[model samples]
Target chain A: MTKVIAGASMSLDGFIAGPDETGFEHLFRWLGAGDVEVPTANPGHTLRMSAVDAEYLRDQWDNTGAIVVGRRLFDLTGGWGGAHPIGRPVVVVTHEAPTGWEDTPFTFVTDGVTSAIERAKALAGDRWVGVNGGTMARQCLEAGLLDTIGVDLVPVVFGKGVPLFGELANAPVLLGAPEVVVGSGVTHLRYDVLR
Target chain B: MTKVIAGASMSLDGFIAGPDETGFEHLFRWLGAGDVEVPTANPGHTLRMSAVDAEYLRDQWDNTGAIVVGRRLFDLTGGWGGAHPIGRPVVVVTHEAPTGWEDTPFTFVTDGVTSAIERAKALAGDRWVGVNGGTMARQCLEAGLLDTIGVDLVPVVFGKGVPLFGELANAPVLLGAPEVVVGSGVTHLRYDVLR
Candidate 1:
């Protein structure tokens, strides 16, 4: 079954992106660092992975079959320059589809997040439908369509910024015990959304 | 050498406590559950610790020799009923020392965070000087006196509340890669403060 999974690298203070939709370079510095052996449970054993950034990107891209993003992110990134990064079917949840981009790679769903997610699920088939952008992910979470949340928590604090979970209308969602993977400079946490 | 260490359990959205200084039962539900083996790095290895709450209380109390807390927290908790839970010397950073509390186990430091930390260090000797409450912790972080930060990140998210790191006067403090320990319902993260 296809699951709706969302992942983002956020600061220790919970800001996924800085104010004014700023780039996440500061929060994601650990990912670009070279490979380093991170300690785990077994005192005699260590797990080796690629650089933090590369591992996260490779895992998400490999596991995802489609992507859903918000209109603001679509505009901010200029629609991924007419080509989606992961080469997946991209659904943009917006009030109005952009003009003169019919040949582009993005599918704009203006109706609502539900319609966008439906389209994404259709495209995803048996793989995961990933959500990007805080607004779109929050919408999926609020609509109870998101099944998993993976956070790459970097060890930096943005005193203020765009909070990953903000302005939700439902009661707090309960999450199963998280699976934590300690990396070079980022700790990866995956949680299953409880119904 | 005495290290100034700060620890707090915060919501996924970065709130250390709820609004109006509300109780942390919601954010801390994981602590009450018992006897769960948390998975770690090694495939065959699992960490068996006490219940989340018990482990946190024990580790903090055992490792700490003295504590520094904000005046508001000191007042809110009624000075921990004239004695701190750790049974160590407590320094309360306030503008003026509370009357009649001089005879109590708490010490009110009107000078500043530095002075409070100094007094805590004197009492702590070679052990850890624990910083409690967000305001006092932020002050220690801003002063470059905090040597480590341990955060027990709960899976719950409060839409809004007292943020863990708020109103810092200095630039973002970089932290070393954290040691991640996944527990029953909480993920404990400890990071070294990069000088």
Candidate 2:
């Protein structure tokens, strides 16, 4: 089974980016360095992560088979910026076929959310397929395509910007209690997908 | 000249809290145990603490000079919770003085933003006077009461909640490029207050 993981770090005030939405400086700050451990056992700021926990994250990253992202995130990263950060297969979800870049090698799926997930699953042999992007993540979640969601909460409030799950077109999707870790006021949480 | 800063975090989906104004679990997660390592270079987070950051934050709970909050936040947090978090002076920017909690020790002065800033500044002394509540933080920014804003972002989108700032008031409060660190996909950045 391919596990679709959606993850992002937001500011304390509920903004992924400022009004301009130009750079990710604020987002990076809240997350600190991924090295900081997440304290899942307790609640509040005292949450801390140990060395063994860090290894678990590192392993997840290494094992992620394929990546699925929306046009928004794909455009923001400049089509993965020449060199794809994640070496595995990358599937970009866009209504229109993107132009300007043919140098890199990745699968660009234009057939909406359902098609993208199917393509990603096929591309992801044994490893899990990771879902990126706000809309695509929500779509996969609503469609019951995702298997897990990893959330890293950064600390800053843009006051307003794009949101994760807007009014669900369908009935609400319920995510279970997440495993939490606290460090530098940034909370790291992960939820296993239901169904 | 005292430099004021505002530190806030939000979800990429542009929501500070969940719908209906009821906060999500992520809200509690972002706060952590309140045991944060206040950046030495950026003392604003810990209100200018000396030790390894944690001590300064711990000390802030007791030694805070004064407290500043917005009208909405004052009503929400104040309405339910009788006593304010810190025992120091509290100045709220509202047309009316709240007579609700005579039991709790809080000074509800309704003079104006400028007067409140002056009064809070004088009392704050070496201790940092914390500004809270989204609306209040904005007013303080407009009134020039804030010295530094310590932002902490979380990774959940409420889609709808009280906005941190909006077109009602837009001011040019400059921010230094934040220092960045990453953990669990959450990036933490610290910006110097440049007024």
User: How high is each candidate's interface RMSD, in Å?
Assistant: 1.8, 7.2
Scoring each candidate complex against the real one, what DockQ results? 0.50, 0.12
lDDT of 2 by residue, A1-195 (tens): 667788666554434455676326656554334455553212333212344445555566677788888878877777655545556767888778767656555678887888987888888877788887667777887787877777665544354565555554542243454565554435565766545
Error of 1 at B156 (Å): 0.8
TM-score of each: 0.88, 0.61
Chain B only, TM-score of each candidate: 0.86, 0.67
Report lDDT (Cα) of residue B12, candidate 2: 36
For residues B1-195, what per-residue lDDT tens digits would candidate 2 score against the true structure? 333344445443434455676665555443343334443222232222223333424444455666766677677764325445445566676788766556454555688766766766676776666776666667776665665665443434455565655422433344444544332312344455455
* TM-score of every candidate's chain A: 0.86, 0.77
On residues B34-114, what C-alpha lDDT tens digit does candidate 1 reach at each position? Answer: 665544223454444456545665666778889999989888878766677567888889998868876666888899999
- On lDDT, the candidate that comes out on top is 1
* Model 2 segments more than 4 A misplaced: A7-21, A24-61, A71-85, A94-105, A108-111, A147-159, A164-195, B1-16, B24-60, B77-82, B98-104, B108-111, B142-144, B148-156, B165-195
